[model samples]
Target: MNEQQRTILAIASRVMSYPSESSAEEREHIDEAVDENIESADIRKHLRAALAPLDALSTRDIQEIYVSTFDLKSKTGMYLTAHEFGDSPKRGAAMIKLQKIINEAGFERTEGELTDYIPMLFEFMAVSPEDAHHERLQRRLANVGQRMLNHLEEENPYYPFFTLVMTKVFPNPTDEEVARLERDREEADLEELPYPIMYQ
Candidate 1:
């Protein structure tokens, strides 16, 4: 990827990360990214719209909202494979493959964070040199990313952020792919799986 693409991916990684109590700094960073004009017009618009409400909320409030949205709600999960494979053996296999790719790219997993976390995937994309490995991983992530956007509520603060991030790394899915993703999401939801606990 080019410099501008790398920059935007880095910004998106931060925006999608789990925020601590100090979210004002994160919001400022996002605002600055929006001003940079590195992203396309649609992405810029969505980024601005997503941040507007978040800018007004306190750090605690933002944390609560995030927890309620992603944690309390199963539909908006952060783990890419979880949405597809749930807690089945297939999900474990997928996670292992992702971890292998991350390791091959010289990326280490954070203490308790999973390889499938979207922000970490973005971070990986931002720094890894463009090559066959990156391209293959990007394709895999794009599939999951499309499904993520489909499941997320459009009005949620993180929705536009995800949309902007996914669009940057992945091509928009076709109509048939969209239909398949919808079906996959529904099937995944029906499985009795343990919820993933976020690293504190």
Candidate 2:
């Protein structure tokens, strides 16, 4: 991808991550990105709208929202592979492969965070040089990203953030493709075990 696309992806990665507070440095980075990419006006507007309310909230409130929205809720999970593979061996294998790819790209995985975390995918996109490996990784991520978007409630504050990432990664997901993703999300929801028995 070009410099503008790289910048946009990096900004989105930071915006979608669980932040304790809206630091001035983060805001400045986003502002500089927006200023540089006039062609991406709609994306910039959507990102600003999504982040405005988040920026106004206190650190504690933001943390609560993050926990409740992502931690407490299964449908809005940030782990992309979990939506498709659940806790099965498939998900574990996928995670291993993804970690390998991320390592090969020279991006360090955050402790306690899976390689398939949505923000990490964006980070990979931002740092990895454009090549066949990047293309394959992006394609896989785009598929999982759409599935995550399907699971997210439209009214959720983080919905726009995921939507922005999906649009950037997928660009042109077909209607049929979205229908399949929605169906997969529904099936996954049905198969999900109750909270108490989930780990057993």
Report the number of the highest-TM-score candidate: 1
Give stretches of model 1 more than 4 Å off.
Answer: 29-46, 179-200
User: Model 1 misses residue 172 by how many Å?
Assistant: 0.6
Per-model CA lDDT versus the true structure: 0.71, 0.70
Give the poorly placed runs of model 2, Cα more than 4 Å off. Answer: 22-24, 37-43, 174-200
Per-candidate TM-scores read 0.78, 0.77
Pairs with backbone N, CA or C atoms under 3 Å apart (clashes), candidate 2: none
Q: Give the TM-score of candidate 2.
A: 0.77
Per-residue CA lDDT of candidate 2, range 1-200, in tens? 76666766787778777874555578787887778763677766877876777667676876777777776666667787776666556777778888887788777888887778887778778878988888876666677667667767787666776676667545665677556655544344443334566564
lDDT of 1 by residue, 93-118 (tens): 87898899889878797778888887
lDDT of 1 at 59: 72
